[model samples]
Target: MKLTILGCYSATPRILTNPTSQVLEMRGNMFLIDCGEGTQVQLRKHKIKFSRIKHIFISHLHGDHFFGLVGLVSTFRLLGREADLHIYGPKGIKEIITLQMKLADSWTNYNLIFHELTSNDSELIYEDDKVEVYTIPLEHRVYTNGFLFKEKEGNRKLDINAVEEANIDVAYYRKLTQGFDVVNENGETIKNEDVTKDAVKPKSYAFCSDTMYKEDIVPLIENVDVLYHESTFLETQSHLAPKTKHSTAKEAASIAKKANAGTLLLGHYSTRYKDVNCFKEEAKEVFQAVELTQDGKVFEF
Candidate 1:
């Protein structure tokens, strides 16, 4: 799996960084996490094909999280895209989008499916053969959710020595990879365990944005391979974090520490600070594996 950070700045924009958008590429599919303003331009800059992104997940109603959605949809139409687009967002998003379409008198020629989220509890929102997406209920100013993407376990490994010794037919290799035992023409039962090793453990990534420090998420994102959490402030400005329903670098690090994530990606930095070194320094004090999220940076797991 590959994750490209399109934007990373917090409430305001900066000369270098954009807003809060990310693209996750998995199994030849691109899944967009957020669509802040200028997302399409960033996608172009990264050489990402917009048509490959059929699924989009909006974290909340915050403008910084989804303000670029309508523009992107319109751009897709202008580009003559005919594939269906699936969007998962908070309730009322469908109304807001269709209202704009009605006012402009421009409707999409392709299918647009909206999955409005009204439930406060976490739920499985999307799934396919290779990947699965789950909602992570979050604490924030507005109703919000984080998303967890997990890659499914791979097929079992073939034990060449055991297969040759057992005289397993090549025609049954596919079934063996599926963990099935087969009988040979000689009337011998070939055990799956003898011919196949264990499957590789799958990797998982989690995205958490625009939320206050909430520990309940530890269980939901426990031991994730890669975790991206919003860190809008440094330890010196921790008082401003909870008041604005945002998180400081230290707070984000604490969550990562408790969740035992393999790597912690810190993003959504406030523009008030001229430098971002403070965020990295503070977070590293708590979680040694923390790293800053830079626009256009690709993380592979």
Candidate 2:
């Protein structure tokens, strides 16, 4: 899995920094997460193809999280896009986008599909053969959700020498790799485990931003390989966290420690601080593996 941070600041876009937006590339699919202002420009700056993004995920109705949605869809029309675009977001998202389009008399040329979510409980939102996505309900001023992306395990690896010695025909190689027991040329049943090794362990990523410190989400993201949590404030300004419905770096680290996440990534920083590395230091107090995020940073796992 590959993730490119288009923008990671909070509330407003700046000349040097931007709001929340990111792109995740997994299994030949590109997922645009949270289209803040200037997102398309960031995508262009990063040289990521607009056509590669078929699915867009919006965490909430907050302006910093989804203000760029209509602009992006209109751009797709300008480019003469033909492929369908799927948008997963809050319940009123469709109405909000449609109203603007109606007033401007500008409609998309491509199919626009919206999967509006209202459930408070965790649920599967998207799935295919190679990947699965689930919603992680979050606590914020507005109805919000985080996203979990998990890769599906592939077929097992074959031991060529063992298969040949077992008198298995080449025609049954596919079945062997699929973890199926098949009859050999000698009329003997071969066990899949005996000839094939286990497949590569699948990877998982969980993204939780623009939320207060909530323990309920820990179970949903337990043992996640990578976790990107919002650290909008530091402990020195921790008093502002609850009041503003945002999390401190220490709070984000506590969540990561409790969830047993492999690596904790810190982003959505408040512009009040001159140095963002302080977030990483405060987070490292509770979690050892901590990484800081900025615009144009890329992470591979």
Candidate 3:
């Protein structure tokens, strides 16, 4: 799995920073997490193929999170994109984008499918053979949701030597890998466990941004391989966190520590502090594995 940070700052864009946006590539899927202003430009900067982004996920109706969506939809049309695009966002996203297209008369030529989420509880929003995505309801000023992407458990691996010793036919190898016992060429019952090894552990990523210190989310993101939580402020300025419905670096770390996440990625910085290392330091006080996110940065796991 790989994550490319297009933007990670909070609220507004700046000369050196951008708003919230990112591209996550996993299990043969490229997912756009958000579309802040200049997202396409960032995509170009990273040399990510725009055509590969079939699914776009918006956290909320915040302009900083989704204002560039309409422009990107139009750009897809301009490029004569033929592939259908799927968009998942909070309720009113469809209306927000459709109204802009209505006023500009710039509807996408390709199919634009919208999945509007309205549930207060977490729900599976997208799934395929290899991956499943679930919504992580968040506490924000407006209705918001984070996303949890989990790779589907893989099939068992075949022990070639064990299978060969068992005199299993080549055709039965597939069955062994699928965790099924099969009759060998010699009419022997071959146990799957005897000829197959365990599959690789699947990876998981949880994106939780624009939310306050929400402990209920710990269960939803338990044991995630990577947790990207918003650190819009430092512990020193924690007073502003509740006021703005945002989380401090320490609070985000607490969530990560509670979730037992492998790594904690801090982003959506308030941009008030000139040094981003302070966020990492504060988070490290609570969780050791912490990384500060910046535009144009890439992380692979």
Candidate 4:
């Protein structure tokens, strides 16, 4: 899995960073996590194919998180893309988007599907043969949900030498890769363990932003391979953090520690602090594997 941070500044844009947007690439597809302002331009600058982004997951209705959505959709229309697009967001998002489309008298020439989320509990919103997406309810100023993207386990590796030694037929290759026993032409059984190994462990990523300290969501993203959590403030400004329904670096690390995440990538830094090392130091107090996200930096897992 690959994560490209398009914007990382909090509250407002900075000379160095934009707002809050991230592109997650997996399974030969791009899944946009947030569409902050200038997202389309970031997509272009990063050389990511816009048409490959069929699924979009919005964390909340906050302007910093979704302001670039309409522009992106319009750009797709202008580009003459006809593929179906799936958007998963809060309940009011579809209405806002459709209203924009109605007022402009411009409609996308493709299938647009909206999955509105209203529940406060964790729920599966998308699933396919290769990946699954779930909502992680978060404590924020408004209704908010973090998204968990998980890639399914791959098929078992085939032992070609073992298969050849066993005189395995080509017709049984598929079954062997699926960890299924193969029946020989002579009515003999070839157990899957004899010619195949366990499947590769699946990878998972979790995105949490614009939320306060919430521990209930830990289980939903427990043991995630990578966790991107909002760290809008350092420990010294922790009081201001929760007062604004945001989290400090220490709080973000606590969640990562409880969830046992492999690595914690912190972003959404407030402009008050010129340096970001304070955040890294504070979070490291609880979680050892901590990293700061810079705009345009790509993290691979």
Candidate 5:
């Protein structure tokens, strides 16, 4: 799995920084995490094909998180895209997009599907053979949710030497890989464990933004391979975190430590601080595997 940060700054876009937007590439799927303003431009700058993004997940109705959605949809129409686009977000997202289209007298040529979420509970939103996406209910000024992307367990590997010794037919190899015992032509029972090896463990990634330092999320994101959490303030300004429903760098790191995440990626930084290195420095005091996100940085796992 790979994640490309299209934008990472908080609140607004500037000449060198952008708001919250990211592209997660996994299991042959490209998922747009947020549509903050200037997301399309950042996508283009990073050479990520807009057409490859089939699903979009919006954390909340906050403009910094979803203001560029309408423009992106319109761009797809202008590009003559025929493929369907799926958007999962907070409730009323469909109404918001439809209203924009109605006001502009412009509708998308492609199919636009919306999965509006109103429940505060963590629920599975998307699932396929390779991956699953779940909503991570969050505490914010407005209704918000983070997303957890987890890879499914893969098929077991067949032990060719053991299969040959057991005289297992090629036709039964598929069953062996599936961890199923098979009966041979000789009426012998071939055990799956004797001819198969365990598959590699799957990895998971979590995305949390525009939320406060809520420890309840630790269980949901426990042991994630990578965690992208918003750190909108420095430790010195921690007093503002709860008031603004955002987390400071140290608070985000604490959550990461509690969750036992492999890597803690801090982003959605406040623009007041010109040096983003300070955020990383503050987070490292609590979590060793801390990394600061830039507008176009990529992380592969």
Candidate 6:
């Protein structure tokens, strides 16, 4: 799994920074996490094909989180994209997009599917053969949710030498890879473990942004391989975190520690501070495996 941060700044765009937007590449899927303003430009700058992004997950209706969605949809139409686009976001997201299209008298040529979420409980919103995406209900000024991406267990690998030594036919290799015992022509039961090794360990990524310091989310994101949490403030300015419904760098690190995440990625920084190194320094005090995110930075796991 890999994550490319197209934008990471909070609230508004700056000369050198952008708002919330990222592209998560995993299991042959490119998921756009947010559509903050200038997202398309950032995608272009990063040389990511717009059509490759089939699904977009919006955390909330906040302008900094989803302001560029309509423009991206329209761009797809102009590019003559035929593939369907799926968007998962808070309730009323469809209405908001449709209204924009209606006002502009321009509709997308490609299919636009919206999965609006309203339930407060964490729920599975998307799934495929290789991956699953779940909503992480968040506490923010509005109805918001982060996303949890988990890779499914792949098929076990077959030990060709072992299979051949056991006189196993190629036809039964498929069954063996599926972890099934097979009956040979000699009526002998060949155990799956005898022919195949274990499958690769699955990896998971949790995205938590535009939310306050909510400890309840720790259980949902426990043991995640990579966690991206928003740290809109520093501990010195922690007083503003709860008031603004955001989290401090220390708070984000605390969540990472509580969840036992393998690595913590901090982003969505407030523009008030010019130096982002402090965020990483403070977070590392609590969670050693913490990294600060920058626009256009890429992380692979």
Give the per-residue lDDT digits (tens) of candidate 1, residues 1-301. Answer: 8999999987645667798999998776799999998899999999999889999999999988898899999999899999999999999899989999999999999999999998888899999998899999999999999999998888999998888788878898889999999986687998899889998788889999989999999999999999999999888988998899999999999999999999999999998888888899999999999888898999887
| Weakest lDDT window of 10 consecutive positions for candidate 3 | 169-178
Candidate 6 RMSD computed on C-alpha atoms after optimal superposition onto the true structure: 1.3
Root-mean-square deviation of every model: 1.6, 1.4, 1.3, 1.2, 1.7, 1.3
List of clashing residue pairs for candidate 5: none
Question: Please, what is the TM-score per model?
Answer: 0.95, 0.96, 0.96, 0.97, 0.94, 0.97
Clashing pairs in 1: none
| Candidate 1 residue-wise lDDT at 134 | 95
Model 3: runs farther than 4 Å from truth?
A: none
lDDT of each: 0.92, 0.95, 0.94, 0.91, 0.93, 0.95
Off by over 4 Å in 1: 159-166
lDDT of 6 by residue, 59-81 (tens): 99999999999999999999999
Per-residue lDDT tens digits of candidate 4, residues 159-214? 88888888888998998887799887677899999988888789999999989999
Q: After the best TM-score superposition of candidate 5, give how far the Cα of residue 28 lies from its true spot, in angstroms.
A: 1.5
Top-down lDDT ranking: 6, 2, 3, 5, 1, 4
User: Distance from true position, residue 139, model 5, in Å?
Assistant: 1.0
Better of 1 and 2 by TM-score: 2
Error of 4 at 49 (Å): 0.2
